[model samples]
Target: MRIDKYLWCIRYYKTRSIATKACKEGKIRVNGDSVKPSRDVYPTDKITVRKNQVNYELIVLDTPKSRLGAKLVDIYRKDVTPQETLQKLDLLKYSKEYYRKRGMGRPTKKDRRDIDDWFDTPESPENKDDSEE
Candidate 1:
């Protein structure tokens, strides 16, 4: 099967187009060399996919007829990614928590305006409020 199609069938990518785009960007390698989306994939081929700031290594065991469920993905590929790489992914998740706490959602318009005001400038120090005068 084509590399992109094979990745999609194995659930490596949510859509075939995403797999193809990754292949075109040279983020997918087969057998230690970069491959195009149309490259043929076979049993025992080693695939290295660079995604989410990690290099995920897997060996093709078999090609599926169609996209597989998340639970059945292991049947078509054997993930050989190093433990350290997965650890790094976990670390990345932890680092992002410092920037935004959970359930905060995105900054609201008022929050943005407040931030902008804080950074823009204070009225000249000499421009005191009537109360101060």
Candidate 2:
């Protein structure tokens, strides 16, 4: 099976097109080497997918005739992704949750203040004295 089709079949990606695009972007690797969407996938091929700040590792078990059910997905591949890898995703999510959503326009006054506070530094003694003068 093609790499993209295999990924979709195993439910790694929602659509084959998305899998293909990810492959084209070099987000998918086979046996530690990057592969193209058209790359052939065979049993026991180790796949590494970089998605959402996580590196998901999978060992292909068999090829599927078509997209498998959620419950049947385990029969096609074995997930070997590290726990820390998944944990990082959680940390990243929670860290970004406090930020404003994209396309929401410019920051508000409070947001600006928060940003300023985050970047604000204390003035040196010389600079402080100069300002006082």
* lDDT per model vs. reference: 0.93, 0.92
Cα lDDT tens digits, model 2, 1-133, are: 8999999988889999999999999999999998999999999999999998789999999999999899999988899999989999999988886676754779888888988999888878999889889
Query: How many steric overlaps are in each model, in order?
Result: 0, 0
Give the distance in Å from residue 72's predicted Cα in candidate 2 to where it truly belongs. Answer: 0.4
Candidate 2 Cα outliers beyond 4 Å, as residue runs: 100-133
Q: Which candidate is the best by lDDT?
A: 1
- 110, model 1: CA deviation in Å? 10
Model 2 clash pairs?
Answer: none
**Alpha carbon deviation, residue 113, candidate 2 (Å):** 24
TM-score, predicted candidate 1 vs. hidden true structure: 0.76
> Cα deviation in Å at residue 43, candidate 1?
0.3
User: Residue 122: error of model 2 in Å?
Assistant: 53
Which 10-residue window in model 2 sums to the lowest lDDT? 96-105
